[model samples]
Target: MSYTVNCSILLTDLPLLERPAAAKAAGFDAVEFWWPFAGSVPGDRDVDAFVGALRDAGVQLTGLNFNAGNMPGGDRGLVSWPARSQEFLDNLDVVAAIGERTGCRAFNALYGNRQDGCTPEEQDELGVQNLVRAGRAVQRIGGTVLLEPVSGADAYPLKTARDALGVIAQVRQNGADNIRLLADFYHLAVNGDDVAAVIENHTAEFGHIQIADAPGRNEPGTGELPLQQWISRSRQLGYSGHVGLEYRASQEDPFAWIAAWAHV
Candidate 1:
C-alpha cells in the first residue's frame, strides 16, 4: 500500500516548487493538489513549472481536483442548469489537457450545489448527462474522472458514497466508461458510513481515495477514526492504488504527522 500526500497541506507559505520537494523529503513518492492550475497562487507559477518541480523532486503527480464552480452568483454546475453544460465541458477539456501534460491520470469532478429550483430526479439526470460528456472528454486525454461526494454540510448535492455510486451507475448505463468514484475518509466519517465497506463494495468504480480523520478534518492520528484498520482493510479489498493524505495538521509542521505514519 503506497501513499501520496496532498500538496495543499504543505502549500501554505511555500512556493509551488518547494511543496513537492517538501512532500518528497517527507517520504512521499507522489502528491495531489486541489486546484494548483487555477493561476491564483500569486507570481507567474504555471502548470508546466509545477510539473517540472515534481519531476525534479522525483515525485509523481497523482491527482488534480477540478473547480466546483460554486461561486457567489455563478452557475454552480451542469446538474441543475442546462445552459452551463458547454462551459462545464470546455472547463473539463482544459483541465484534462493539463492533467495529461502533468502525468496525472485521476481528476476529481465536483458535483456542485443542489439549488431549490431543480427537483431531485431532475438533478440526478442532469448530473449524469454532464458526467457522460465530461467522461468522454477525459477518456480522450487518457485520464479518469472520479466523482467526489461532498458531505451535505460541505456541499449541496451528492452527499454520500451511495449517491455517488448511483451517478456512476447512471453514467455506465449511458455507455460512458471514463467516470469513476473517489472515496474520501473524512467525508465518509462525517456522513457516518463505514469507509472500508464502501471501498470494498465499490472497488470497481473507485479510482482514488483521500483520507483525514473525522470531526476535526485533521491528520488521521489526531481524530478518533482508526486509520490503520482502514488501510489494512483496503489492502484486503485489493486496492493497489495510492491512498492520498489529504488532511490538515493540527501543529505547524506537516512532517510531524508524516513521521508518525512510519509505524503504519
Candidate 2:
C-alpha cells in the first residue's frame, strides 16, 4: 500500500507551495490539502503557483477540501451555512478548475456546523442543494464529492459514517450520484464510532480514507488506535486507494512510523 501525504497538516513548517516538493523529498509521490486559499476564488497568480508547485514537485494531487470558511476560527464548513451558500457555490468552479489541471477528482466538502438562527431542517435542505451542485460541477471532470465526519467541534454535526452517508444519500436523491464518504478513521474513532465495523461494512462506500491515531491526533503508534490492524482490515475488504497520512507529526520526521508499517 502507498500513502498520500496530507500537506496541509503534516508539513506545517514549510510554506504551502514548498510542501509538495518536501513531500516528494520525504518519499511521497502524492499529496492532499485543505482549500489552499482564504477566499473562494484566488487570483490567477496564486492558482498558478499552487498548480506549478505540484507539477514541479511531480506529486499527484489526490484530494482537496472545498472552501471551508475560517477553519482556524471554528467555522467547520460552508455547505450548510445559509449565508455562505453562494460562497460555496462560487467555489465549485475554482475547485473544478484545479481538479481539471491536477487530475484530482476527489473533493471533500465539510458540512458546516449547526447555526443559531437556521432550523436543522433548513440547514440540511440547503446542504443537500449545495452538495448536489458541487457534485454536478465536479462531475465535468469525472470527480467524486466527499462528505466527511469531523471530530472535536461540538457545533459540527457530521460525526459518524452514518451521518455522512445519510447526507450522501440525500445528495444522490437530489440527482447527484457522485457524492461519497471520506472515511477518516481518527475523527470517527474520537467520536466513539466503531471504526472497524465502519471499515467492514462501509468499504464499498468510501471514496477516500484518511488516518491519524486517537487520544492525540498524532502519527500512528503514538496512540492506541490499532491503526495497522484497521488498515489491514480495510484492504481485506477491498479498499485499494491510497491511505492519506493526515496526522500532525510529533517528531522532526513525520514519517518515522512508516518504517513500522512497511507491510502496509
Candidate 3:
C-alpha cells in the first residue's frame, strides 16, 4: 500500500514552493492538493508555482481537486447549474493541463450543489453529464477522474460512497470509462456508513482512498475509528492504490504525525 500526504494539511502553512520539499523531507512518496486554482477567488493560491515546486522536489503529484465552488458568488458545486457549465468545463481543461505538466494521474472532480427543488434523479443525471465531460478532458491527458462525494454540509450534494458510485456507474453505462470513485473515510464516518464494507463492495469502482478522523476531522489515530484495522482490511480487499492522509494535525509540526505512521 502506497501512502500520500494531503498537501492541504501537511503543507498548508508553507508557501507552495516549500510544500513539496517539506513533504519529501518528511518521507511522503506523493502529495495532493485541493483546488490550486479558482480564478483568483479569495483563498485561491497560485497553481503554476506550486507545480514548479513539486517538480523540483521530485515528488509525484498523485491527486488534485478541480472544483472549489463558484468564485465571487457564494454558490458551491457545479451540477445542475446550467450557468456554470461552461466555466466548469473550461476549468477542467486548465486543471488537466496542469496534471499533464506535473505528471499527475488522478484528479478529484467534485459534483456541485443539490438545491432544494431538484429531484434526486435529476441531480444524478446532471452530475453524470458534468463528470463525463471532465473525465474526457482528463483521459485526453492520460489521467483519471475520481469523483468525490462531498458531505451535505460541504456541498448539499452526493454525500456517501453510494451516491458517488451511482454517478460513476451512470458514466460507465453511457460508455464513458474514465471516471472512478474516491472513497473518503472522513465523509463516510460522518455520514454513519461502514467504511470497510463500502470499500469491500465497491473495490472495482474505487481508484483512490482518503482518510481523516470524523468529529475532529484530524489524523487517523486521533479519531475513534480503528484506522490501522481499516487499512488492513483495505489491503485484504486488494486495494492497491495509494491511501491519502487528508487530515489536519493537532500538533503544529506535521512531521511528528508522519513519523508515527511511517510503518503504515
Q: Which candidate number would show the highest TM-score if scored against the true structure?
A: 2
Residues 1-264, model 2: lDDT tens digits = 379999989899989999999999989999999999989999999999999999999999999999999988999999999998899999999999999999999999999999998899999999999999999999999999999999999999899999999999999999999998999999999999999999989999989989999889998999999888888888888888889999989988889888877576
Off by over 4 Å in 3: 40-47, 70-76, 116-122, 152-155, 258-262
**Would you give me the overall lDDT of model 3?**
0.75
The sequence of per-residue lDDT tens digits that candidate 1 reaches over residues 20-87 is 99888777789987666442232334666877888888888889766545443443344435545555
TM-score of each: 0.85, 0.98, 0.87
Q: Across residues 182-250, which tens digit of lDDT does each residue of candidate 3 receive?
A: 888887878877787886788777788888876788876676877767776777777788889888777
Worst 10 residues of 2 by lDDT: 255-264
Candidate 3, poorest ten consecutive residues by summed lDDT: 36-45
- Among residues 3 or more apart in sequence or in different chains, the pairs in candidate 3 whose N, CA or C atoms overlap within 3 Å are 77-112, 78-112
Which of the predicted structures, 2 or 3, would earn the higher TM-score when compared with the native? 2
Superposed by TM-score, candidate 3 places the C-alpha of residue 253 at a distance from the truth, in angstroms, of 2.9
Cα lDDT of all candidates, in order? 0.73, 0.93, 0.75
Positional deviation of 98 in candidate 2, in angstroms? 0.4
Off by over 4 Å in 1: 39-45, 70-84, 152-155, 258-264
State candidate 3's TM-score: 0.87
